[model samples]
Target: MKLSGCNLPGITVMVFVMLSSSSTSAITNFNVLNFGAIPTGGTDSTDSFLKAWNAACGTADSTFIYVPKGRYLVGPLAFKGQCKSSQIIIRIDGTIVAPLDYGVLGKSNNWFSFEDVSGVSIIGRGTFDAKGPSLWACKASNSNSCPSGATTLSFTNSNNIRINGLTSLNSQMFHIVINGCQNVHLEGVKIIAAGNSPNTDGIHVQLSRNVEILSTSIKTGDDCISIGPGTENLWIEQITCGPGHGISIGSLAKDLKEEGVQNVTVKKTVFSNTQNGLRIKSWARPSNGYVQGVRFIDSVMRNVQNPIMIDQNYCPRNENCPGQVSGIKINDIVYEDIRGTSSTPIAIKFDCSDKNPCTGIKLQNVNLTYLNKAAQSFCSNVVGKAIDLVRPNSCL
Candidate 1:
């Protein structure tokens, strides 16, 4: 089959010639260096990257855009596609550095973006370095003049994506974001940033489904993994998170059009020196959303504050949140086989919404303790049951 032209924003035309299954298969490799990409790390290579992406997107059959080892400087780049071929792979072994000046990135919220694409795979051990120290310092010092820094990597309105063996460092904002996507798989990824870096979430999933995050190590400022509104069927396992806010599903109900999240399972994760471990938080405002059928199992926490928390009145920075009860509903959640050392006395806190109280919460074999003292559980407007060997004594 000969795939033809498609239109994309900022792209005039895309021509792909895909081969049918019955036909002889051919794979094409487009190297970024061949497109005048300078690996000296001084010159901007954004145009070279765009050229390679365009070539791969326009090619017929399976295509690989290769970035070999070296340091290459680039600004914000977007790979938008409705490619002729379904298979477009980006194999990166080089380091891609973003400009240190946030002003140069202007208005673009992402350092590298893939949008409206399918059957895309980004693999290979590479680094995406967003020189974000200056940006972080500006934000830390209350310099309101700083521009909003960009996420290191983002996928928007894309599907059937696989990202593996990538290292993201010092991201200005979130390290990775999957937004309005489906059937995405991320494995063996690493994210690193300063604990005080503002808004530098490790991985954020929002408005997405059928996402699996496995064997990832994240050390960042904000939540290691944040599941936002409209996320469903998300499976996270074997994640090592530290020096961050830990994993969270939350701050929902800020938007009325937000959709509920369901069927999220996080298992076999470890949190060390994190602010909060295994948290579910929702804003105290009137908005329609719900979270249900969530499970956290076989997780270990060390020196974690708020080891197990459910805060329905989650107002950040004590911003004087409205007194209105949260409209988001929380139900059918389970925390099992969680053993942790808590940094605070209240290791388990369930502060549910006054209007829509959480129900069907189950705790099984949960052991959390503070230094030289048994941890405590605090419950408010929560309905739950404790299974066998529950520690810290459930207060439901």
Candidate 2:
């Protein structure tokens, strides 16, 4: 069946088609152009994209919402779920540009949000072009006057989600966020922003479980991948990160009753010219949380500031941080086959909390150097074991 198209001034004509039978389910294509989206890069295509999404969500058959190759301007969009069909795909071969003005986007925290979705896949070579230079300038000039910028893409309360082969650039905030999601897979994703862009984390995972990030490249200002509270069974592999804060687990212990991150593994990653390579940080305050069973293996670092670190006294600049020791318990952490060159002399630092010290910290096959000299290791308030060819080894 051929679906009707709406006509708008300066908009191209497109058609949607669906073919179905009693024995066979049809794959419907819902092109955004048919819903009054003008890809001239001038008109706001938010409402038109929403119309296409609504149609795709209400269709009983499998649907593919297509965004053709063009520059389409859009604003904040939320694609809510409980879709009529189990399978929904968004195929983008175009660039979606955000508005330059943050005030026009309002206080929304996300540019594109997918919530309560299952069996959904967003796959393409498209780009999310977040025009964030103005916002960054606003933030750099005056901290308090800067609005809360929006993440480029967000998935909330979603399960069985797959995001692959997409590029997100110059996000005002985080490039992508996976929150309260399960069984999500992100592969071959590219995230890029200025190294000085404030708070532009590559990918932030929070309150999620069973997530896999594979074969990705990220360069941003903040952490390449930040695993926040309540994440479990996360496997990150084959990632390349640089000009950013490297992969990290938590700046936790800020909340009174924060959830713990457990059973996370990062392997076969490379960090170049980043602030930290593999770090687990927590605030220096009394909080109820724990991080356990985490592993970092087979990683390479080049000119990284801190290659392997565990800082329990994490306090950002300009804040009057407390002197109390962190209450979070860290245990059963392992770092193996981590060979790196550090920008600083102190490559391996385990500055754990004095009150609740770290336990069962194991290091194996770790070789770190600085400027053709052996790097140093600093350990305090931690008990651990090192085995098999540890270089520049220190007391643990």
lDDT of 2 by residue, 278-366 (tens): 99999988899999999899999999999999999998793888777899999999999999799999999999999999999999999
lDDT of 2: 0.88
Off by over 4 Å in 1: 1-25
RMSD value for candidate 1: 6.4
What value does the lDDT take at residue 126 in candidate 2? Answer: 94
lDDT of 2 at 137: 90
Worst 10 residues of 2 by lDDT: 5-14
RMSD of each: 6.4, 7.0
Quote model 1's TM-score: 0.93
Q: What is the overall TM-score of model 2 with all chains considered together?
A: 0.93
What TM-scores do the predictions have? 0.93, 0.93
